[model samples]
Target: MVFTAKEFLQLRETLQIAVVKCSERCLYQSTKWAAELLNSLPPLSVADIASSQNTPGTYVHPAFAPNNDPIEAALEAKELGQYLLAKSFFDCKEFDRCAAVFLPESLLAGLLAPPNDASSPVPGDKGKATASSSSHEVTLPVLSQKSLFLALYAKVISGEKRKDEESEMIMGPQDLGTITNKQLLVVSRFLKRWFDERGSGAGESSASQGFLEYLYGMVLAKEKNDEEALSYLKESVQLFPWNWGAWLEMTNLISRVEQLNIVTPKLPQNIMSFIFHAHTAVNLYQQGQDLAMSINDLISVFPTSSFILTCKALLNYHSKDLMAAEQDFSNILALHPHRLDALDHYSNILYVLNLRPKLAFLAHLCSSIDKFRPESCVVIGNYYSLLSSHEKAVQYFRRALTLDRSCLSAWTLMGHEYVELKNTHAAIESYRRAVDVNRRDYRAWYGLGQTYEVLEMHAYALWYYKKAAGLRPWDGKMWQAVGSCLQKMGRDRDGIKALKRALLADSYYDTSASSFGSTGPVDRMTQMDPEVLLQIASMYDRLEEEDEAKAYMELCVAQEDGGAANAEAGVGGGGGTILGDSVAIHADSPGAGSDGEAGEGAERAVGNEGTGVTVATSKARMWLAKYSMRMEDYETATRLATELCQDGVEVEEAKALIREARSRMEPVNMMES
Candidate 1:
């Protein structure tokens, strides 16, 4: 298994403290633990070993016995001598020759009496059997039993070229007596110097000192009889508070204590502590460098937190591990199957993961919950919409509105679906409902307007478009819709007005410059506005008043480019060109129009009530008079232009238009004669 590194380090630290403590506590109880801790290392003695080599309270140097091995008492007597030798060698001090003369006696027996002499070759009476020994007659040097034993062991293992004990280097010292104050001071001096001068790792050792001591109480060091193997660590930390390496050791030790304090306990305490731990874990998890451990522990401890699961799932999702994130979300579902937030989030996850099958699954789930929660119906509707199932999408949308009349999004989408299905009337109704549900919804109003425009109901379409525009006046499309509907109703002037508004709101868009609506296949309609202008031009053209038709068509042409071009002469500098151009109008001709196409609107165009007559309308009246001339009605043509010259009336082009009108009237009536 791939281990999370941070978690592994934490586990290792905790394990070290635990195993160390176990070794310490079981040292004297189980031989295995003790052997593991001590490794059969020796101890130092405060007094001498004796003639009863291995016997207690007997003073005999172990090496000074009459034979190779000695009685128990002799071994105990020499214990302090072995320790002193070890201390002197490790301390780099000279050995005492007087102590060496007794041979194994001083080496083995320093308790009852001091060695007679050092390096004297003799078999002395001290080797004689002495049955009684007095405690008061003995004095031993002071040494830390810990350091003394270690120093002796160091010599034993040093592989030095020693002549007498070459083959006996593996022997272990048996009865190292109590530690002396001087030896302890020597060990302490070494420890203090190492810690004080070492790198900042000392602080960690200090922090962990108490904890280490606690564990040491149970098991000695792996090297010797003492519990701790690391002597310099605690001293270092004590000497340096900022020693992080040592501090880390301490933290590890503390963590192990904490972990073991409860981990192996019965369920009741563990569970209670777990609950409390989980409370703090979440915050710490995000605090940097603490995530993996936090996650592992929390999930193991408090596996039921839906909120945590969700947050974790989101983290995974954002991390680009969809499979893992999906698993978390699924687990969350198991715990909170009816979670609305989960449903929404899960659907989105599916969308991103491109899990088509799961999309359907989410759609079904949302659909099933439609009755219980109206909002879910909207989700189902959108899902179907995404699937391109407009019919079903619309069905669910309507169903959602049925469940809750205030379902604004459902109403809005239902309208859109209807539009997709080409049911403009139904679409308009749905859009209207959406707007009613939320009057602030400009989109629904816009939809309603566009649908009406599609249905060819320009006036009603214009009404809705205007309302939507009012809501979001800055919206380019809304303004575009208004202009389109107005233009469709044959009000190009108003269309231009609305389209300009669109451009002003959003200068970067093309909505304003683009045409308002379809004008069929008529080239004339491209430029024609002031609908009366087109009507008059057509009337004159059909009456064979070509010159008048030509002049009026030019004005219509100018108006088509921009309705602003066709304004009255003094009205805001709008000077419409007077000359008309020949237009290829594919729509109905004059006769077709004289029927219902030209109704009240046409009559209003030619009526004599207004002074500023449209160019096309004015031409239409004069053309009617000219047409009468073909039937020999000169009097009627004359009455049409009573202020013009009386002469030949030709019908050709621009000049012909003026020529004809002059012939149809008396010159003297021109200026109100």
Candidate 2:
């Protein structure tokens, strides 16, 4: 059936509205309707319209021959019809659909189609005007910029190579060489011309501008010109700050430069402000601020956001509020069970809470969902490690490595397993591989240091420990190791300084509250080897810092709990351990061993007359007796002195202290009190 000019005009408008819905079924119906309309319309030329005018063809129709522009009309109709039919099958979410319809080869071929009827211009060509026209005319608009952009986006989404498993490399620069060389060159030329024509308007184009920049940046980064690519990404974020894709691309670009220690241009102030606030709460939490309180305020502001709740849950986990963290994580799981990050962290909470069966089940579920994912394998491996199934843990870690050679956590955890089995050589190799894969990982550095310390290579251990401490200055454990290492090397003053820094860092990280809702004692020296505590005490003594010496010695005695040999021996059953990886070893010099022996002798008179005396308790009493004598509490000193004499250890020093205390002649009740 032939259509009147007005009918075709009305039909095209109706089809345009349908195409805007952008659904597969909607486009299919629109395409079918367009095809029927195209079939009914005559292929009218300017010559035919003009001839009709001369014939006074019953008042030449306005819609069919409005402009006497046959080429424009033909190109517009052709572009609309082709775009509708092709786009109907270009489902962005379906890889197969995109691959079949909008492949790079297919798209490039369409771009290279010969000039239609010689009246249409190629992509960049502004066709020459006729002899009757004064100005040059072009059909460049027939290139269908929107269709080209959508197809490019689809190709990028479909063809980009994601990592086999997550790693730092997942955020590393991509290799966008999926298309052939000829296709790449042609596509590059077309994009360059497209940019030149509309570049001025790009920044204001919002979503389109950001996406275009992201694509260009990806191409440049693939080719390894990071500086230029970074520039494009920076522009992308600046132009479209709300576009998550552009922001993620910018983050990847920044990570690429930062990993290489390459200097990047300063981001614009607006973008920096945007980025700063995103991470501010996390940084504050790491610095030991109350994240739950801060996050509660944020939750009030954005009550519906799962991300804020997730952050709060993670902060609670770090702060050791296990119950609160479990609840928050459970809430998120109920809402979004497929969130992998939440699942991984929630599984960790289960493990920490000693819900081993639940942890194993969750890990099994994660692996069943995607066994090839390195993270899933690593999670299962971690559960086995916690169970002391070193052999089983090693198998899973190896599996993770097979899936992703760049899995940094797997290498580090493998080292920890070797350490657990007391295989120093294998542990060292594993830790070295971990550091090789990721130089910035403090855990790997700490692992290497621990192995060296185990081998008694003090200098190597000191170097690696310092590296770990430098990477994570907030971690008191590394500083504690550094202090112990320096003391081993006979650098008493430096050791003292490092130990004090460790104490300060430990305090800074103590965010947990007591039952009374007050901050508890921040000193966490229980993790230190009792021998290290003794050495620190000795250092204070040599420095003539009596009060400091007494304080550290008291902590040492409390840690030892009357079992001096346990202090001398390496920590058994992982007493110094946190999270199964760390092994606590107190570095002891030959001189320190003799000092410990002397301390043991002084500890002989530990208990009351009827009570059994232990070496550590006697040492504590001896130190307390000396402290009392120094303070000139004669009565208490004389009592302690008599006890020491009866016990027959440190008798000479006790007698001397008693004599000195007695010379002060203090009242008995006042001195005792």
Candidate 3:
């Protein structure tokens, strides 16, 4: 086995190649061969190997270099063996083993390797690590810069793995928190050292530098230093414009920062096209452009991107294209079953579609993977609530609150569950917590109002309803609640104003039948709508203007008849009145007939409800009878009261009025005699 120096170098290079190309099992099998190959090699420095002169039929061994430490050769062999083993483990996803074997060896190799004089200053602050020239030089039997980075990466991943495993353990919260904190601290120190490693020096490409920055950004993100993390991640993309990994990292950081209303870093013009296209499409959707078109254009460029497809599907769901959105989401799930975004989005779609079985499956699957994610917990809670399992729903909702107390929707939903369970006090507390979490949450404010209204706290209910109205002025139901609360509080003028606003916002707005249990028999089921009209009429009547009251009563009659007609015809007017138009009927004036529309309009105003006109006649006749009696017009009063008795409403009152009018008429007749 006598060999030239070049032959020895070639043999070592061949063994290094074998180590890289073999699998873990193959490497183990070849371990003895590698050891023998290394042991048979002469103690020759690279310079000695290069300087050796070729001699015919003989090996050339040059003079030893001064810096050639014999121990360095052994250390190199040990470092190479460890690096290969760790790499194999890493490739197999055995992070713990990789970290255990590689990190120490990589560190020791750097310390033992002689520093290079030709290398530049280490990057970042002064006193950061500097790499020797041989650090990343991928020669035989030496740890390269790639190996060092991998070792650090494995260590960080191992820490994360421990944290994840411990989180799933049934340990005390305090103990789990302590252990997780220590693991994070260990990872943070390693990341700092990885960043400080000057050995992965200027010779590395800008893309590699970007990778380092990305890793540092990830550490900063874990520490909740989002601003610095964003800065480093942005720097990474700027340094390596071609790296998709960097782009994905930037997208994740931007999404999180934007959720907190934090300003994102400005992207450079040289940004990657796929990210730019996707970002632009989403931005256009936010700006109220045609979301479908934007998403279509994005998909045209990136047809296979699940992220883009998911975005398009979400946009479709929002736009009410449920079937199309469902199909797209299904496609994404089929392609990537574990995609969190797709799972989250499709869960909502399933809920909306009332596909309860699928929703349950999605909730269970998502919870299995993301047990502590508040949104996933909330989804599970909603599934239980749908099943009328308020008790189970509360458990999941409470778990969501524990995970993130600031999840306002969870609090609001918990309030809904409490309300369903008739736990008014708990409901109130949950709503209050929700509002405290986000003052702009009108749902919480409305919930509080509803709860107070139910509790007969009119003043408190009014205050909360007003707050809700201010937050969501266009919500006609809130305005209606405000009106009802005001009316309960005897604020007639304000009540009328709120009621009118409610009508203007939503003409069909009606108070819930269940809300007025204690106050009045009037509710949506029992024509609560007509009650609103009557309330306005009474407010005017209280001002001693009987004519206006009579007019409103007529309008109420017209609305009732229209609703009946719609129902009989099987035409859904959705509880809206089909009064031809807003025709002002003045007090003390006979109702005139409007002719030739879809139906006859008040054809014979005095008593014909069948034509949508006579519905008002019964109330009108009653009011006219009262007015005539008050004016001493006895005959008119008697006749009108008699007609009122024929109608089904106010029969006993009409009979009494008739008796009184006739008795008074007898006196008048005697006077005439």
TM-score of each: 0.26, 0.54, 0.44
Compared with the true structure, all predictions reach lDDT values of: 0.43, 0.54, 0.56
TM-score of 1: 0.26
* Residue-wise C-alpha lDDT for candidate 1, range 1-673, written one tens digit per residue: 2434444343333333434432322222222322222321122133422322356666443223342223323443556566445445444432222223222234334442323433333455453323223322342332332323234333222322131223221111421112222222223333333334333453322122232232222122222333142333344334322222332232222222234334323223322234323322322112112333444444543345554466566444332234455677888777766655445445444543445576677677766655456557666765665566788877777666555555666677677777778887677677776765456565677777767777888888788878877755644456666776765576655665565455344322112111111111212112223343554455456566666555554454345334334334221112322212111100101011112322322222211222234444344445545555665565655554442223222223324444464565456357567
| Candidate 2: tens digits of C-alpha lDDT, residues 1-673 | 2445655454444433333322322233324433433333345567655554646657744333332345434543656655564555464355325433433464555444444433543455444424213222222233333355555555444443232322333212442212322233444445555566565563322224344665577666555576887777667656534334444444444432233233223444442223323333342334244444555554553354466667777665544445566688778767656545546467555554555676787788777778777778777976886676888978887788767665777778778777878888877777787776566566778888888988999999999999888766755577888988888888889998777666555434432322112234422322333444566777778788887787666555454333333233333222331111012211111011112332232122121111133344456557767777778666777887777787677878888877877777756656888
Give the winner by TM-score: 1 or 3: 3
Point out the worst 10-residue segment of candidate 3 by lDDT.
585-594
Question: lDDT ranking from best to worst?
Answer: 3, 2, 1
Q: Count the backbone clashes (under 3 Å) in each candidate.
A: 80, 2, 6
Indicate which candidate wins on TM-score.
2
RMSD, model 2, all Cα superposed? 17.1
Runs with alpha carbons beyond 4 Å of true place in candidate 1: 1-371, 507-673
Q: After superposition, how far is residue 641 of candidate 1 from its true place, in Å?
A: 46
